[model samples]
Target: IEHSIYQIMKEDSLLYCLPKEPLQQAFRTNKLSVQGTVYGYVGWIFCQHFLERLGKEYLFLIHILDRRNPVGEEVLEKLKKRLHQDTFTREYILDIRKQYPSLLKVLYAHFLTGHYVNQAEASNQPTISYKRLTAMERLPGEDLAKRIKEVTTNYHERLVFEGFLCFNKHVLKTNLYQTTKVALSIRMDPSFLDEIEYPRDPYGLFLVYGSEFRRFHIRFSDVCRGGIRWIRSREREGQSINVR
Candidate 1:
């Protein structure tokens, strides 16, 4: 009886939420007003029904986290060091090590060494070029490591790392609204945003829950690239329009 019960529980655990057909259709057509199989409302309704079948205990499966915080430089350094020393399976390690090539011998060595020398020349640094074939000439893995060490030791690189860290954290959160909000916040970067142009519209809504039955107005600009006025109606002809 115990073994049979365990099998039943395991089978139940295998059940997964079905793909929201309406949401998939919206992405396919890039339109919001489609009904019947295309209406996301039906998918949402089905989700509510599924949740009821699972009972209130199913709420424990939800994950909660704030994802905007950036990881420190110390954290990145530690992770990099750990990754460099990683030794799990021999096959995986060999696959990665094969990606790095040491400076070759003979004429090939001189040719490959010039690639690095040319970079120094472009940067106005003292340059070395070899025209002769020699077996001794080789750039060690340490040379590549040194170059990366110098490249990443900068304020701009640190800023970019911070942005990447925040993005990674946001992806782990796995909530649609939180992911969108974090991405919108990061787009405020001036370096790239200034050269690009985009439209704006005022889109707003509120998600209400809990005992107080309170209201929280949400501004689309706060959670998206800009305000986009979605012209939604029961009529088929209505198309979404927006202001810039």
Candidate 2:
């Protein structure tokens, strides 16, 4: 599992997406925080390779989104064994309901108020709204909230990790934005790309990687005063002619 994931990272240009100067500054200041969601082996593998490349004593925090499931438990055991005696790491394997009550409340209020969504849309960048949150369910806000509440109470639904991550993106940008240098997610929904608006001043980087048929492709975008500018590799078709 580890080897396969490492190969994917290598082939997919994971390191290329990161800006070198900001990364080095992060390491020097010792304020680097790498946060991501882990469902199974692949997520953990990405974390391992990421830390190895960072090449220093850094902190890693991962949320084990599937702690209750059998597969989740299996991976947890393997991860514990692999990361044994690692000092600069912390793992959270709690139920989502108990883990983030305050955050949930804030999200609930956002849904009802739609203040953030309006703000984002007026700025031409939409915040994560009820439409984005229930994109999978295709349900109304009231219904979706009820379903999420059920999951919170019973903890039977399989969307535990997905729900938490979707909701947490808002907090990452607002509450935790200053401290968070880099945030990554694996196999995220394509719609999420539009929702993320990385701050230009503080230099926060968000990377999302997705794989199809064992091959990985990445898209890089940054915000400019005009709009979002896409940075593509020169290897892309019809671009080499202009490389000189």
Candidate 3:
């Protein structure tokens, strides 16, 4: 009976997408909205989700403190606080080393872009496609220890580690909004948002959950960019239409 009970619990543990955070932010912003399957809503998951987790990850903590690496001021102040603790034990080090590859696989899955090509007649909520490659396809289990070392030295690389890094011609013209509330909605670099040549609409993202995972999550999900879903719905350029 004890073995039977253990088997049932182990089955339940295999279920991913167990929710820890709200999957979408209920915000009234024009620039963009963002979401993730696990943590819910975000603009820049890199900072809110990735960096926040990196700070707490034991493997990362151990790597950042190694004397052989160079860390930035942003991370150095964090190191000062971590200095006083008895952070790593022999067992903890060994376990983190073992867990490192699986962790990297999960992290790398979020780096590539998600694009869905379906239409929902309801215009306010056009469903985005988020097909995830089986964990093994996206994550190379090779030299994971060495790859993790890169993140410790430069925290910004965590964003790169998440997906295939590419910017679409659809720049999500964030600056067109008159208020700072709009520009600041996207928490990452706002370099291209300027006073001239507004060419694109602000495209937002929502988390994949429930049926979205089954219906979407294709392994070759990155082949088509998802911008057309937003672009087609808008009034033509040079026309007086502001889509929120």
Q: What digit string (tens of lDDT, one per residue) describes model 3 on residues 6-71?
A: 333422332222323232222123111222222112222222221222234544555556645555
lDDT tens digits, residue span 1-244, model 2:
5434433343234333332221233334432211111122222222222222111121222243455777866865656444432422223223332354343333434333422223222344433333333332233455555656655544322234334334333323221112222322433333333211222323233334232111223343444333223455557643432221
**Residue 163 error, candidate 2, Å:** 3.7
Candidate 1 Cα lDDT to native:
0.27
Considering TM-score, where higher is better, how would the candidates rank from best to worst? 2, 3, 1
Which has the greatest lDDT?
2
lDDT score, residue 112, model 1?
35
Task: Assess each prediction's global lDDT (C-alpha) against the native.
Answer: 0.27, 0.33, 0.29
Native RMSD of candidate 1 (Å): 27.5
lDDT of 1 by residue, 44-109 (tens): 221221111221222222112122324444454454334323422223322222222121122123
Worst 10 residues of 2 by lDDT: 32-41
TM-score of each: 0.15, 0.20, 0.18
> In model 3, what is the error at residue 86, expressed in angstroms?
15
Q: Which 10-residue window of candidate 1 scores lowest in summed lDDT?
A: 179-188
